[model samples]
Target: MPVVPVGRSADNAVTTSPQRQRPTIAIVGAGIAGLAAAWELVAGPDSQGGDGPEVVVLESSDRIGGKLRSTEFAGRNVDLAADAFLAQRPEATGLCDELDLTGELVPVGASGASIWARGRLRPMPEGLSLGVPTRSWWPFYRSGILSTGESLRVATDLVVPHRGTVGVTGDRSVGDIVGERLGRPIVERLVDPLIGGIHAGGVDDLSAAATFPQLIAASRQSGSLLRQLGRARVPAPRSAAPPPLFWSLRGTTASLAVALAGALARRGVAVHTGVSVDAVERAGPAGANGATHPSWTIALGGSGPPPTGAVVMADGTSSLRVDGVVLAAPAREAAVLLGPLAPVAAGLLSAVEYASVALVTLAFDPGAIRSPLHGTGFLVPRISTFDGRPALITGCTYLGRKWPHLARPGDELLRVSVGRFGDSRPAGLDDDELTAAVFAELTRLLDIVGTPVETMVTRWNGAFPQYRVGHLDRVARIEQSVAELGGVAVAGATYRGVGIPACIGSGQTAARLVLESLSAGADPAGRSPGRVDPTR
Candidate 1:
């Protein structure tokens, strides 16, 4: 491996360990990634007596753990927002155990889904298969979502010949793959809404490699997704998981914030809320690890000049001089800041797109809905567009049915996520207008005649990131650019993934890079043993 030259800090110590009595590691965002990095660095299997990385978590928001908001409504707990991270992801679940939060972990309910495709609440295709179909007509036959013809079309995937090679380096759009394998209707009726809801992109715009990589891999390995029925290794179930683990959480996801906060606290990480970061830059000694920009300097006051180190900008900030750096913010945020500094990386980051969304949580009386929300909830297909934007009820969860610990029988919770990219409702619409719009749509779709008992509208201006086709190429270019820049590492939804697990993976990966860089700088090994390839 070749060594990259970098600026060095003459003052600070090169190494950090628990035995040093005081070792500090700074994290900019308090979201799962930031908190997870803090948890692992301070409390993971690596926590030993060699001067542990003392952690300092800074947040621009008033609270820590961005987006995972579980709150109270009408005296019962609710997760109006992000529910649970997929248990199969393992990163988030693993942290839960490391933090002793194993008991708080809960499974999602699986009463099944109600589709609104052919215009009715039919059961979601019997064997979900996500975007991939298994039984010829499972989704169409089993789901009220599609027609018999549509079901037949979807089954055709069994014979859909392999087009391109798929692997970590391969890429394909969900729309392209689905439509090619399954006809247009199945793509529209089943694939559009289901895959669209999760990705927040028009199927044509989302990447199969990034958004539904597993399904893509399955399609590759099985050679026939339709035939791999009795066998697909489904997402694993949790200790107290609901519905065998394939959907969102029942209650509000706010507790994820609470749990993470508790974990960071126990590990002695200083949580700073309501503080904003301005920029990040490289200035660390080229630790034997070529990736470590050992000296990092950051400007904090938003206007005044500031601090530096292996500075990790986990916030929604821009470039600053720092030795080691990690960016755990969203894709757009990363692009905005890194654009001027690392144009190639920034452009690649920019290539990875995002979609806007609005989530409306509605609380209804148990008797109002046509059927009990048995499982997690229903999903709205991207095809069911409202005013050019996909408008999906995404099904309502019978909060009372899923979790025994939450909600009374009479009190029911329904989270109706509304909108996808550029939904043109009047910008001036009052809260009442938004609320009315959500309820009206739900009532018309689910046959619920009554009004919601409670309501909330969360507008994530740029909440969901869209990973498009050719995304892999762009990210690879990004990695190359950053590698040349030296000593700086980037993580978060922008490069690798968007979910909680993806973000956790990205952030920890950044930390690991920094650690690895430190290791490389000191050790003659030059890089991780596996990474030391002479092929290049």
Candidate 2:
């Protein structure tokens, strides 16, 4: 492990002479997480020692914004990846507020979504908490997805006796607990679709404690999950209006990323795109030169050219020495960077698997769909099949209906998401093949009257991380181990969460750890792990 110089003050942290040296911190990766980290270092309050340190962001790719990207299409802007984020979570909305984007933030439309299952599109049952209906029978039975007998079996959950404290231990899969209490039918039809949609992973493999804390907390009570959820449900006040449950910029999400980069530029934080840091290693005591601050040697030029400014400082070499480093790449990349330095943490990170999903956006004439489009979109149950085979397309969202701004009169824009965990159909299909498949599915489900005017197919390979059972435990261990390494911190969707908000929070928190260690000139292992609030 690399050891930072611990004897020098800010006045003489890293210079050869008596002149003072401002600590130089390098953020590897310019994705949302990496950008968020730079935001923290340059914007956070001055440390007890003095002012903030000099910083630089290095990205392997020419483009920024890892997943939050949007572009002009169909004469309007639309997100290619995630369209909206969970507004209920403060991490993302808080960033929007800080960035002064409140006015542009818009909630999803009033239209709700339907479920495509049992060979039909049925209205989703009301009172579903991530697929667990509040009651046993009413909504589930009326949904028509479940038969009368199956509906009665769900009702048994309300009267069923205790199963010796399910989901009370370390951690369990959502499918296990939900199936044990509510029945497998509900797990297959309801839980898998909603929760699985969010993670793109199987409910049977997802960690209940890590993914649905609220459900697990409520389940610990005396009643069933349904009764507990019913008791916990708080009705909104009729007099007061509720805000939007999801939010995004008026334009593309990429605008936010661009705005953040511009903000970093204004702060004089060196921004370097198309530069990849191949390796991070300890400068060794010989390179530390008796200074108390830790020293790092960053190797560049594997994925892209090194930054121009950094190239000179590299003195014609492929490596440059820095005071500290923040690793904000995806889990797979992070694992590769950490393998030589922190083998254990790298191994833990490599163990986390990822899934690939493809999005097909199509524009059609408003009159093309003869039937009135109902709700925002429809999610196909995993059990759904087309011509006696598993359905390739997972879900569909009517963009124009959901957000009126994206379409003009007589225009209908639809975004279709295809693929799931352990499914290779999405990645295997080309643009034409995927578009035809999704279009065929949409026609089969909605009976469209005409062909699409324009269409786009975007494939995201290994973008979503699967939070398998014991995810929290793995994250805790990963963090603890990294803390011991002292001068480095890791942040991204791979660690705590996978949403925009979670990634931002993780970046900010990682920056804090790096800044703190640099300021104190001490080993991080001796101090508390980190300041990030895991609950958020």
Candidate 3:
């Protein structure tokens, strides 16, 4: 392996002169968050009208996008993971507007979805706030998702007055609060399937403060929990139609990452894939004068030979020296890198757990369907059973119906999700067996007749970071410890949020911290950086 040293080209030729030397910022991952961080470093307000910092992105995998990926299936680009992002968040849309991709954005065509309840597929109750019905009686009674007894139990929230203000006092699990107010039936049938499905973990231990802070505020009110949540909702203009709940790109959601990577290349940002970072160590002694920040040396390893002009060490390892770094890798990888520098941050990161999931895309003939496929698809509650045992399938999406671009005249495309935190059933089955099992469940759920024409299975292991109780406090401590290192910052799903928008915001914030340190020569106060305005 050859080492590509700083200030040198791939052919061992000097690229930048000593007179034109500039600060170099290294981003440790090439995922969406890392890419967003690189963007903020070069394209943000601080970089405009001047020579920007030299930015380089390193990724371990053969590809750039982490869990955001797509493939050519059934002659169209189909997402194997998340297919859309929440439209209410501005980070994703704001970044797309800057990338000249605003015209390619597409809104969801379908609305509403079903939940498997009482051994049948029933429409989700209207006026739901994250699976907790805001309107107490009519919607639940009409949908019939809950039994007559369960429906009456929910109605009690309207008349019953809870004693304590536990929600506002401190951190608590989502299930603990919802079940206490709305009854256990709602938690098992609605809350777990929706909220739990989002994190790929049971909400019984999921953090309410981190995931849904609004729930806490609503719970503090004295009146009905249902009415309180209804009042808490942000109302749209009375005359205007409500905006789309989610958005996706024309080709695939993964195009956002690809487009961002190309934009980075055009701006002279070097993005290297298939390279693993072995360690991050202090480069040398601190600078002279009033400088308190220390530079860093990053060790690199890969299967291929090192790029020419790299500083190959005596041990045959390549290394690069950068003034600052954005550690945007996952929690496990971040923990390993921070162990030597910030042990507290490393230990906190190590404690953050992740969940694995698998997406199975199947194409069926239009004639095989027995019931009209309503809405986008349906979700299976954790308590649901099939074949006299717990169901392995969690949810399913009608790809062709939801995204008209992927529709075919004779083909009905469906994407089924399997596996969640603490569920090992999907892991035990091979591709063929898993596909068959999912198909069998679908046959009963959708009343299908024949086999699928084509099938594909994609697995994402440890993709979702579980936000357990007290997650936000833990994140605060982690950031404080990393800030003490002066020029180092952490970003990605593990800290703030897991959605595309949240991850993008996380990356941009980290970039701002690095920029501040680089400009001031050091961050002595170890203060938390403010969020970069998405509009800016």
Whose lDDT is greatest here?
Answer: 3
Note the clash tally of each candidate: 57, 6, 5
Task: State the displacement of the C-alpha of residue 3, model 3, in Å, after optimal TM-score superposition.
Answer: 8.0
Higher-ranked by lDDT: 1 or 2:
2
Q: Whose TM-score is greatest here?
A: 3
Each prediction's Cα lDDT score? 0.60, 0.77, 0.84
TM-score of each: 0.81, 0.90, 0.93
The TM-score of candidate 1 is: 0.81
Candidate 1: worst-modelled 10 consecutive residues by lDDT: 1-10
As a TM-score, model 2 comes out at 0.90
Q: What RMSD does model 2 have? A: 5.4
**1-536: candidate 3 lDDT, tens digit per residue:** 54435457533222122343466788989889999999999986666555678788998888888878899998999988889998999999999999999999998878899999998999996779898877556877889888889888888988887664745577889998888888899999999999999999999999998888878777777878888888887765576667888999999999999999999988888688877888987653235222345567788898644433346766778877666889999999999998877778888899999999999999999878787888889999999999788988999999998998899998999999999999988889999999999999998898898899999999999979999999999999999888767678999999888999999999999999987877676546432223211121
lDDT of 2 by residue, 1-536 (tens): 22222233323434322254577788998888999998888875572244677788998887888787887888888989978887777877888787788888877774568888777788887777888887445867888877777777878877876554655567888998888777788888878988988888889999988788767766676666678877676654566667666776787666778888888887887667777888887654222455455566777764455543343322444555577789998888888987766677788899989988999999898789875677778888788888887887788888876776675896888899988899998777789988998888888888788799999998899878999989998888877777666668999989788888889999999999887776677654333223222221
Tens digit per residue, CA lDDT, model 1, 219-277? 56535555553256563356573344523333445665667778667666666676555
Residue 59 of candidate 3: its Cα lDDT?
89
Residue pairs with backbone overlap in model 2: 4-294, 5-292, 5-293, 5-294, 6-292, 7-292
Poorly placed runs, candidate 2 (over 4 Å): 1-18, 45-50, 135-137, 163-167, 231-240, 285-287, 302-305, 308-317, 524-536
